[model samples]
Target: MKTNVKTSPILHLTYAAVCLALCMVLPFLTGQIPQVGSALCPMHIPVLLAGFLCGPWWALAVGAVAPLLRFALFGMPPLFPTGAAMCFELAAYGLVSGILYRKLPKKVLNVYVALIAAMLAGRVIWGIVMVVLMGLNGSAFTWAAFMAGAFVNAVPGIIVHIILIPIIVLALRKAGLAD
Candidate 1:
């Protein structure tokens, strides 16, 4: 028997809203941790979720807007450099994830492969944005800093995402909340 499961746009929108709000709250949890605060924000979760559920564009939209909105509303990001940097990075993540997932053949490999690719690509974009637009001032941009800022600092959040997001997606799929 074929099941007539349908995914709702409103539900996806609600998911985006909640994820954006969660991103807003993340700053509070690490606001005083020097560079660590912005580096490890859980905002990426919603963006990825949107991509996995809706499509690349929706994910990109959520990723691009969430940080800026949070900054505007709650002063989380505080200024231009980090905020602008994140726009590109987050957008890359969404775009890469969606693209990779669609192109890959295996469902088991899809999320992990896409996620790793997205993470790498997003960080490359983030590093480029920081160096080109934000600049390191007198300091040079190195692999260590890139890895530290782009990857290491985000390790926990990355772990959280890898562990939780697929399960969430699967649950949503099972409950007829996702495609």
Candidate 2:
């Protein structure tokens, strides 16, 4: 008899917890290097990966909670706007990636497509969050600023995600760890 390789609640929760932990720890480790932490966006890797590994809801939970949890534990990302924006951004990333990955054909190219779409959606959500938060505070955030942060500053992280995520996912599939 063969067992079906389906994701159970326990597995989902376990993976979400692990991903959340990684999200918190990656930032802390990268934060030691000046400018690299914000630029490279270490926190995003695991959240996106969780989207691929787990389903949307589990990934969303990890994404939504990680920033605040990190702030509470480490006091790195201040609670007000940055953490809040990050929450929305990462939540979008996880949700979109998972939805696309789950719905699309099980092919390597689909992974890249989903990842790219998720990245764009996350950035858009981040920009929207920043606009509202900044506007309410009498501060200004321009589209140009959003573009710079989302694309220019995050080029390295984007490249890393493009190269690393698919490779990891494919490896997991090959190893029979992922479907």
* Residue-wise C-alpha lDDT for candidate 2, range 1-179, written one tens digit per residue: 65566566667778788899899788767777887667888889999999998989888988899899989898968977889999999999999999999999999899999999999999999999999999999999998899897899999889888999999989988997776
- Write one digit per residue (lDDT tens) for candidate 1, span 1-179: 65443445666567667666766776677666776555555778777777777567667877888778988897767546778888888888878877776677647657787887887888899999877754545556677877887888888777777887778877876897766
How high is the CA lDDT of each candidate model? Answer: 0.74, 0.89
Cα lDDT, model 1, residue 40: 53
Candidate 2 residues lying further than 4 Å off, grouped into runs, are 1-5
Best by lDDT: 2
For candidate 2, the per-residue lDDT at 127 reads: 94
Clashing pairs in 2: none
Candidate 1 lowest-lDDT run of ten: 2-11
Per-prediction TM-score:
0.80, 0.94
Q: What pairs collide in candidate 1?
A: none
